[model samples]
Target: MEIVLYIAALVAAIGFLVLCVSLAMTLTSLKKTLNEVSGTMSGLEGQLQGVTRETTELLHKTNELASDIQSKSEKLNSVVDAVKNVGESVNGLNTSVRRITSSVANEVEKNEEKISQVIQWSNVVLEIRNKWKERKAIDEGRSGYSNFKD
Candidate 1:
């Protein structure tokens, strides 16, 4: 009975020691996993910082580009306004020209009969002048022939 009790005690001690060894091994493995997780977290933090800096720079550049575009758009608006003014001036000029042309056409229509009468008078005057020149030439020819005979 004494030997059996001693054997039982030794067995219990051996089981406890085995349990402690297993627990230690498990704890060591967990520690190594935690260290690896810590290293990975540090690398991720550094990458995140780099991304944040690049994002800030990009945001600044985008703002500058937007400002430049706004300025150019404002300048373009002035050019568009000038073009509109020119178009209005051209339209006014065209209207004036059309009015003048219509007035001239109306005046020409009103004077159509007078213009025809004037043309007829000018033709009659030209015919009279031609007849006088013919008479002068005939008289000169008769005088010249008489002097030649003499």
Candidate 2:
């Protein structure tokens, strides 16, 4: 019985030593994991800062482009107004030409009767002159002249 007691005491001491070693190893592993987490957090922060700077620059550039487009739109509007003015002027000229053409046509219509009368008078005059020349030639031939005098 005394020998058995000594063996039992030795086994308890060995078990206690094994427990202490396991606890130490667990603590060391936990410390290493915490360090890795800290390193990863620092890397993420650096990336976030870079993204923030780039986003600020992009916003500024977008605003500048918008301002430039606005200026160009204003210029384009002026050009469109000028073109509209030109179109109005051309329409006015077209209206004037149309009025003049109508006036000329009206005048020509009014003169149609006078032109017809003049043509009739000219024809009558030509026929009378020819008849008069024939009569004079016949009269001279009967009067024993060789030819009618001019």
lDDT leader: 1
lDDT per residue (tens digit) for residues 3-96 in model 1: 9999999999999999999999999999999999999999999999999999999999999999999999999999999999999999999999
Which residue window of length 10 is worst by lDDT in model 1?
Answer: 107-116
lDDT of 2: 0.94
Write down the TM-score of every candidate: 0.66, 0.54
lDDT of 2 by residue, 1-150 (tens): 998999999898899899999999999999999999999999999999999999999999999999999999999999999999999999999999999999988998999899899999999999999999999989878776655543
RMSD of each: 4.7, 8.4
Kindly report which residue pairs in candidate 2 clash with one another.
none
Q: Cα miss at 138, model 2 (Å)? A: 29
Our tally of clashes for model 1 stands at 0
Give model 1's TM-score versus the native structure: 0.66
Q: Which candidate wins on TM-score?
A: 1
Candidate 1 residue pairs that clash = none
